[model samples]
Target: MKPQLAHSRDPEMKSSLQELLIYMIFLTDLGILTFGMVSTDMFYLNKVMSSLFLDTSMSETGNTNFKSIESVDDFWKYAEGPFLDGLYWDASDIRSSIAVNGTTRHIYYENLLLGVTQVRQLKVRNNTCSVYPAFRAFMKECYGPYHYLSEDKEHFGLKNGPEWWYFTSQSLSPWHQGLVGLYSSGGFTFTLPKSKNASIDKLTYLKEKGWLTRGTRVVFIDFSMYNANVNLFCVVRLVLEFPATGGVLPSWQIYSVKLLRYTTYYDYFLAFCEVIFCLFIFSYIIQESIKMKILKEEYIKNAWNWLEILLLLLSLLAIVFNIYHTVEVSSLLEYLLSNSFTYPDFYLLALWQTRCNNMISVNFCFTCIKIFKYVRFNKTMTQLSSTLSRCAKDIIGFAVMFIIIFFAYAQLGYVAFGSQTDEFSTFQNSIFTQFRIMLGDFNFASIEQANGILGPIYFITFVFFMFFVFLNMFLAIINDTYSKVKAEFSVMPSREFEISNRIREGYRKALAKRKLKRKSTSQNAILYAVRQDRRDKE
Candidate 1:
């Protein structure tokens, strides 16, 4: 049956209007709820999809095993073919049947294999060897147990030992393997098998002496053998593949690169969103600076806008790159070829592409912006002598303050961290770690691990500096500088104005002097005429 539509012009249409309004409200609420639910589901689905294989070589199979799987056909059959869509991945290598309680349960173990599933205990069994425990041992063997955050001894207790994060690396090529050390800005290191020394450059002589063969199995250890003190973050493994040609040229030999996912994708998604928001902020700043009429210094404003534009453009590029990598699986080859001349494995590329989109790319763009703003733009001060002295004073004042803060934090870190911290115990480390803390990344967990007496004090001091002193000081300096610069520009006349005023004054004075001279000459001529007339009459 068709429902009758009521005309709103009639007074009797009140009932129909109320019903329509109520239906509209209900529909809006339902739409909002549906959208929210769909967004959440899509986010989770993206995470799952991104974790799939994009690395060229997905595992850390030994050279011998990798050699056995040589040839494109065998490679597909043994490794690539197994993980393709619709093929059942045989967990048979890592899976074991264990007796739990009275029955047997299938358990899959997570060893050192890269691009594989994580280990999870589905059920508990009596006298059963769960895969998790063995996986932990295997992890210790493959990737050393180093941690950025140490446990709190007073709270968690010493008997339990230190809580740590494990790091690992997998080889992509049969002979050439790479290691990446993770740090705030830690760089990468490549470890080549003795045979691949011909392909890799800058390898230590000791590595060359080790065994040189195509099939020899070699472990590229990250930590120093002489010292048990392992780096808190060092490249466990990074696999890069290059062309099969021998070339000394720096640009030609480089191939593809990849990094593993130590953290989740949401961490990156949130970061990418942050990059967009940051670019928005830069755009807003540019608009605001343009609106600031009081600032007569056009160069400064232009420089600032240029930086803002550069940052916004870089950020947009990063966003587009991330979106492309996220959506298309084949773009990795293009990215590697353009940037580093290497085509990273699919999984490595996926990890690299995802990580690039998330934090690394954003951070890189941010750092570049900061460098240009502080160092490059500030150098322009040298070109103008009037502002040079003031600029020098400001620079020196900031440098001294920075030095004092750095030393104070270094001392605090040294006293607080003591021997418990590796890669951050020395004076240099104390300074670096202090800088990280100053950036609001102070880890209380690491602070609680120090010697009972000094640990708490150090932790407190560091936290106070980071959260209270540094953060507040940073903002305060900006506020103060803004006030000073605004006051100067607002009160003082511009250089062009002063020059124009002087020129007009000179012209006015010249005209007035000319008029005075003309009047004097005219008066003198009249007196001479009068004197001549008197003489003629006499």
Candidate 2:
């Protein structure tokens, strides 16, 4: 009997080992699949995606002046102070040229289009123009003349053209693009027209004021040059090359590239693993459905089943979109390579990629949530579900009533204090502000400033009804439900465990009955053989 028992236990141990091996293999496969996906994404971002967003050309050039007058106009509209006050230059100077040895004073403007702080060197002829003599003198006094003056013509585009007068300006630090920076080294030349007389009186007036001297010309510099329209175009081009925001929409073109790249090696392996796992899940669901004998509609009525169906549908969509996007990108690349100068329209590609990303993000979230289904078999989870189920209707009713009162308070606050406080400036803001107040972010000073008398009354009443009364009631309902659910769960086994226990008991009984029948049959056979022998003897 001991040997028989040990033999029986050997099969069970083997079965357990087999199950463990399968689990380990599955986990390894899952890890590989995840690693492959993530590695591909990182590679794409580093190698390809990042290039799409960065303006490599601009970076190489160091200073690419904004060409549009609209940008300048926009800059002037928003700029203030004496430095920005008279900073506008005649647009006609763009095409005009400065004389060989002549000096003229003019203002040159540069817009830092990308909102980044830049150090720029402006080169000018030795006798050309002096940039804001008073400002320059102040900078020279503080930081020294060498720090504010550089004679490097080749560095500031002097070699490009003889007519070009270089002007160098250091923009405010990148974090503070709104503020103007102090005067820095370098200068630009502006040529007075041959026919027009030099304004000596104006020069003398400026000279007496120490703005200019016999040799130095004066030029005013400003660096507030962001234009919305120009920026939109830049953003689109940038997003195509890198992973930055293109206006309001997110850029996911690089992510798509990574997904496509990884598919070459891991696609089949991942697919095999996914299919095996999904088949098991599908069969289990089918078995459950058959046992329940429920209609299709009834089967989907379960939240968990609905989630499974949704996950399946989303996965299918993701695969289809991925394949389509890959083909499109490949075709576009081929065409671009052949044409050289031609560019493909990436707007549709970006749009499709955005949609795909949204789908992927939603699928990832649902996958995370689906883990709860397996955990739902646990006793604590079962009790939690029961408590939530029992209290759902009451919670919904309370929420509806609470919302009505909350909205009323929000509207009242908006109407009463909208003019006085920014938080309560509108109906929408008032609602958010009221929520903030509940979270203890309320400012009594702002409320008191709005209306001293009504402010305290509103605060007191809102806190009493919303926080003290309704909030306590809400907590009490949940606590009571939890207590009841816990007591019930302690007394009775979970539904899943109860069903499994019954099945195991029935299987054991069936095995016992079969053994008894087999033993009885053996005894009958022995008796029959003895009877036959006695008959032979007779």
Candidate 3:
């Protein structure tokens, strides 16, 4: 039954209550979406990738001949560090593993591509030097003008290896390829014949060629590590874009992945739920579009409306990608199932699926933000909203000033300590390292040691301005606005939600009707008793 609104006279209140009620129905769909998120991306995909985790440097796992990388000093140490170490297996192992005892009918593979499109010698030092330490052997020493970690030779022991490499651009990307060279795949050191007059290190070679990133900066550690008979393909792809400084532009993706199913029952059920969720989003979009048409300018003006549009766009992209991947996977699998000898090239599909998951995460965040719009009428929430909006202009001004000073300090630290300290090795690293210093993860001794006089001066200025002055000023602005909002809300009496008021009104009327019926029944019983008493007296 449609409930009556308490503030019937206020048409605006009535309309808002109606809208809130409709939104509640749409909110039910989030339950399924959340389940899919936790089940698939958070747990399931991690499990699949984890199952493939191994130390590629070890003999048990296949090896990589890393051509795309610039440095080889700590390559052995790196091939085993964080995340899974990618593997390279011959096609025979892949085929034999799946056909004999494998529950997995098919397998797919992808190369572990590392580095930005533009590879630099400095970045090679930055990425590796301090990241993977062997022990108390003191790995941070690598973060120096000189790679001093080599002095701790007992810990840094894959010692007898290439001090340099040559970059030969691959006119072909080896997606259908795995590692070459010997076991442990160690020979990246490019050597010239003894007849030659001169030899070049990796750094000298890149400099002479005039550094380019496209093919040389990246390493594709390919994997066909189809574990004896177990099924999995695992690798990582990551790049941080700096815009004039960075933006991650897309490159061609390889279709070298096979979709996995842990259990057929859950897979089918979750897939069905995904279809339902997508359909609900489509319906919700149509409803919101109608409202958008009715309230054109106002709709566009509202930030919450834009969030809805973004959520819908992300959701739409995910849905379209999912459909395309499904069709493509099915077509490929159909051919593969028949032509059992053929290796699968579904890597491109896997890459896009991962990207799709990232968008799902964005959609989830926007969906959560949209919740505030529906709950804005709440007294506490209204105060918070008012406080933020009131100080928004001031905050914006503060933010601009903050960025200028922050960049100034970051650049200063980068230019000063970048040569000797890992924390300030790159402009971006300096920016983030400054943030860490703010958060109290600072290494003061290192900062001071980077340069005795300038180091201390730079830090003192950064702290005094950023932490002591700007931070407190920003906090004061927020505190002042909050106090004003609190006072304003306190002066105006609060009303319960219109939907809650309607439900209470229905409950009160039902209670009154029940009491009236009981009263009439009691009177009727008393009259019957009185007539019985009169008959006994006669």
Candidate 4:
């Protein structure tokens, strides 16, 4: 991270102070915004809580308590409400209260979900006491002797306990309910209680806990009405939970986690970019101002090298940010998979949404600076020419391969789809798909629709070309060419000098060949004359 000077006649430290000052002003404004974000975090939490409460029809119970608890102790004290007394058990009490008596009071029916047979309805009551385990023996306590750490809450809460976590969505029809979307180490896998119809001899077994009869229209079952004496209950409880559910469960506090996540990454990325910009400014200033005796070539080369390395790192950081976003998106996909309703293509539409835009901007900045480096250093045209020639050769090779494949696929597509559908029936549709893949605009839905409308012949053909042929070829080319681009500027030279050297070499070779020919002819003539004289004397 050391700042080095530029190599020049005066090497006046590249005075970028003005530029640095402007950046500092901008950063100061940004700092205010960042501070505001932190300060408003509580406000965002309240907003999320309000939204969730509205979604669950809890707003009518009373004015929503969107107050932020500044600490875990505050959360615990609030949880001592009468409503939680019946649901959770402390670890000491868990061993004894293997079974609990609970009457299902009322049930409301919802029909939005697709194939799910049953969904649970959360009951509300002002007088009902909420059950909670004592901290000393709470099975959900993070630091307890027998408690398991809860991913959602840092401290013990009803959500941290197996009883509450499992019941949260157990009876809900997957079709109507939204599965919490939280990114995890891998794709999502959730386990629920074994089916009631499962054989008794099966390892998984449960007893009917209780039933709530709201009317003839709806019946809610409280599965905790009965408890089985088995050592495998904890395993069964663990199975009911989602593997990818790392954030706060979505009941009340999930939005807080989501907002915090977005805020954290967003600020970090912005900060990283700012730091890089600062370093760049500082280096430029030092290069212009410092006048230490250093070899001009060595100094310039080193400074440029440092710039290149930093630019590469910036690109890498942007890539990681994009990847993290992609992971978040994949988690959202898991939620959709768990539910049955078809939502509009929000994720697809938002794919390039801010996340991709930031990455693209970062890449553009890096590339612009890189090109600027060559111009600023006044690299010779001959070097530029050589670089362009190599690039041209590569382009030609790639074009040839692409054209051959395009034609081949287009022809095959015509044969397969021409009679069946208008889309891929002609060579043009095949070419369009190829173009889309190249531009990273390929759409699975459109492709599938084309196949469905046309037939299996085109589907199989296009799939083969898209996956086995195009994907591999494109990736190989890009991966192979990356190093070439990185090394290109180092070996640039003047075109005029190269041509002159070639001409001189040709002239020297021609003159040497002529001299050799003349020597051989004279030697032959001399031998012939000597032979003739000998014959005459004899």
Find the candidate with the highest lDDT and give its number: 3
* Every model: Cα RMSD to truth: 28.1, 20.0, 13.4, 25.5
Two-way TM-score contest, 2 vs 3, winner: 3
The lDDT ranking, best first, is 3, 2, 1, 4
Report the error of model 1 at residue 6, Å: 58
Q: What tens digits encode model 4's per-residue C-alpha lDDT throughout 1-538?
A: 1122223311322223333345456445334333432334434433433443223221334422223322323222222221122122222343342232221110111101111112222212221222355643543322111111222211112233332332332221222122322212211112222221222221122112221111101111111111111100000000011112121122321211121123356566765755654565456456444522344456556655565556445545645655665585556446646752322122221323334444545544554454434333233543454455556666677678767867776776566555654545457776775566555665545544545654455556656775677668766665555546537655643212232343467689999999999999999999999999999999
> Judged by lDDT against the true structure, how good is candidate 3?
0.52
Q: Report how far off residue 108 is in candidate 2 (Å).
A: 28
Flag regions of model 1 displaced more than 4 Å.
1-344, 355-396, 411-418, 421-449, 460-538
For 1-538, candidate 1 gives per-residue lDDT tens digits of 1123222222333333443444344334323322321233334323322232222233444231222443323333322222232112234453433222211111122111121111100111122222467476554322121122311112111222111111232533222222221121111223222122222332233233322112111222121000011101111221121111211111101112222211356545545545545555466557655655555566455655565556556555555655655554445435634643221334433344444444444544454344322222121332232344445666577668867866876876676575677535677777777667666666667666656667677767657865687667656766666566656755654322122333467689999999999999999999999999999999
Error of 3 at 240 (Å): 18
Model 2 TM-score relative to the real fold:
0.44
List TM-scores for all candidates, in order.
0.30, 0.44, 0.61, 0.22
What would the per-residue lDDT of candidate 2 be over residues 95-187, giving only the tens digit for each residue?
545222222222222211222111122222353334577677554322112213433344232234322445442422121111112223344
Candidate 3 or 2, higher lDDT: 3
- Per-candidate count of clashing residue pairs (backbone under 3 Å): 17, 14, 17, 32
Candidate 3 residues 301-413, lDDT tens each? 88877788888888888778777876875786587567543334444556666667667777776776676676555567777888989999999999999999999999999
Off by over 4 Å in 2: 1-72, 75-259, 263-297, 340-343, 375-377, 409-464, 491-538
**lDDT (C-alpha, whole model) for all candidates:** 0.38, 0.49, 0.52, 0.37
lDDT of 2 at 167: 49
Worst 10 residues of 3 by lDDT: 178-187
Best model per TM-score: 3
